[model samples]
Target: MKSEKSKNGLYSHFRLKSSMSFLMALLVFVFSCSESDDGQMQGPEPVMPPETSMAPDMSMFDDEGGEENRVNTIQNWAYAAINVGVYSSILYSHLIVPVRAFKVTINQEAHFNEDAGLWVWEKSFEVPSRGTFSVRLTAEVDGTDVSWTGYVSKSGVFENFVWFDGTSKLNGESGKWNLYESPENPEAWLSNSWEIDREVGNGNTSFTVEKEGNHQGSSITYSIEKGADYDRTVLINDVSNSNLVEVQWNKESKFGRVKSEAKYGDEMYHCWDEQLQDSECP
Candidate 1:
């Protein structure tokens, strides 16, 4: 028969083993729902079509206008048109940085966030001449609609800068991205927000720049149609003067035209040649 001291030692050993088993089971339970992709979720990151596919090519006019005397000075028509063109190009140029940050995840790996039950693609890196940035893209599927969000953070600058959030069909045929300007542009148009509606593979995209608060009714509509006659187009609506100024051009040849009801005093297209000098319409 065992002595009483030996019986107590046996009990202590049993209790220690039982406690360790319980701790191990608890750990397994906790990690069972941890973040890891194991073939039970959607595919890779939501498709982010290249920005160049829709970005307007207005650089053709970079070499035009601003000439005092070019033997082509009809009301400085080309100059007026170039002003509008410059504005159009600048509107979207600011967004390229953040947009590209989100696109970098296209070839990278993403893990399923089991806690959130969503596929998350996130990155933190430095962009040459753009400083450092962190971007997150979350995608969820509810029915045929794929809701995607692009959130960004700049080190020592800002966090949760929602660059864009929009939805698209599962097939990626059509969608719209609501784009917001970066904090770097402190003087951006007051309460300004941009919307881009695109039909992928169709070369169809529309842009709308809007302002809120005290600057109401100052919205502008612009577009770029690749195969159309006037491929580069910027339409500015002057609500105060009840005028419409349009700037259009071809990317390859830089041949373009402009017109404004208020300034021009008539409905006629002011033409410009390949050299961006004033030209008589044929």
Candidate 2:
């Protein structure tokens, strides 16, 4: 009877220990599952998108209407006239012989007509021994060309002159001008002027003048060619007739030279030095 009781006690103890171990395992599994559920309740991390850029505003370049275009055209015409008129005054005043050494001051006035959309500019200057010179330029709205008129008064005599763009006839004379540009040299430009059948002393005369220079520098060179009948006199001086004349000058140095061979055995070879004094040709 004692042996049987001991066996029963041992069996009961083993069964109880096994039951407690199973309970512990069940508790551990329940806790782990609860933690997993908590994680599932929270959604996936937020995904960031890429940034984008904005386009530029191009409204400033757009023309609002035809008024802006018209205004721009008028402004361009006026500016071009101013430039050409100023240069022409300087060329005729300082580049030509006889009065090449004189000092000149130019006064300019500009006006615009809003109703007619026209631009007019006047430049006046005095040349020693030559009297007063006035140049007037007029341009219509959107016109491709400008009309120029010049007047000179000396002593008591007044003379009127007009310039021809080579395509137009002025004073029964046809004159033309050509502007040249060099593709290889951006600083170089040349202009040539020609006139045929220009009334002079007794008959008509033909003349040509070429100006070549680099705007980047202060030096310019000119070549003049002329042809006229024996009975005809030159328009410039009326003293002599010439076939060819060459001139060169440095505006910065305020020095220049001229060489000419006249038809009547008169030859002119002069150089204006930096001192503004006439000197022997170099």
Candidate 3:
């Protein structure tokens, strides 16, 4: 009987040990599975931000800037040709340089900021002396070549001295301004009433009939700084009562239509030079 009891106790101990070993193994497996699942849930690899490039150095472009570029890069006018001159007369020397009329390679693409608003037609020209000059510009406005003309009523570089004799006869007015042409040339005219407008440095000046109505006759006499003995001409014509009248330059003279430049650090009358860098004009 003692031998049988000892065998039963040994069997029981073996069975109990096997059950505890199995439970320990199962807990270890569960912990390992939980750790693996947590690692997978963390997500994909992180992405780094892109690096930025340094700013470029701009000193090279500054070296090429100069007055020549500013002067030559004048906004070319959009037209076949521009007509500029002073009226022909002895009072105003008849300096005639024919206006070369030609079209640019491209029309609308050529423009500059002289006025600093919308681009307007611009050109570069030179006169031999200083005097009163008139410019009659005919350009293609709205794709149509219409003559939109204006004049420089005063003197400018390469132009000096001016003597203009103009006459006007009003419908009801009495005596006219008896004007005479000086430096007498082939063309001359005598007038009763005349008006001349002059503009100095910053102040721009223009002239026209004061009141537009039934006027008898009107004339314009341009007096340049230099010219023949009496090279004066008159543009006398009768017109119906209207504010808008067709006027002409008494003579054809050379005019300088340079590109407009920035007017910095100055007033209109006392501002910068044509290029607007500094006062280069003497």
What does each candidate score in C-alpha RMSD? Answer: 11.6, 33.1, 33.3
lDDT of each: 0.60, 0.33, 0.26
Best by TM-score: 1
lDDT of predicted model 1: 0.60
Could you tell me which 10 consecutive residues in candidate 3 have the lowest summed lDDT? 47-56
Q: RMSD, model 1, all Cα superposed?
A: 11.6
Roughly what TM-score does model 3 have, to 2 decimal places? 0.16
The residue pairs in collision within model 1 are: none
What ordering of candidates by lDDT runs from best to worst? 1, 2, 3
A best-first ranking of the candidates according to their TM-score comes to 1, 2, 3
Name the weakest run of 10 consecutive residues (lDDT summed) in model 2.
Answer: 47-56
Top of the candidates by lDDT: 1
Residue by residue across 1-282, what tens digits does model 1's lDDT show?
A: 479889999999999999999999999766665424553444444555435323444555443434554335534345555455544554545566555765675666766676575667898877668788888877776666667777788877798777766676655555666666666642223122223345522243444444343323543444556677767666665555566777777767777788776766878888887766678765
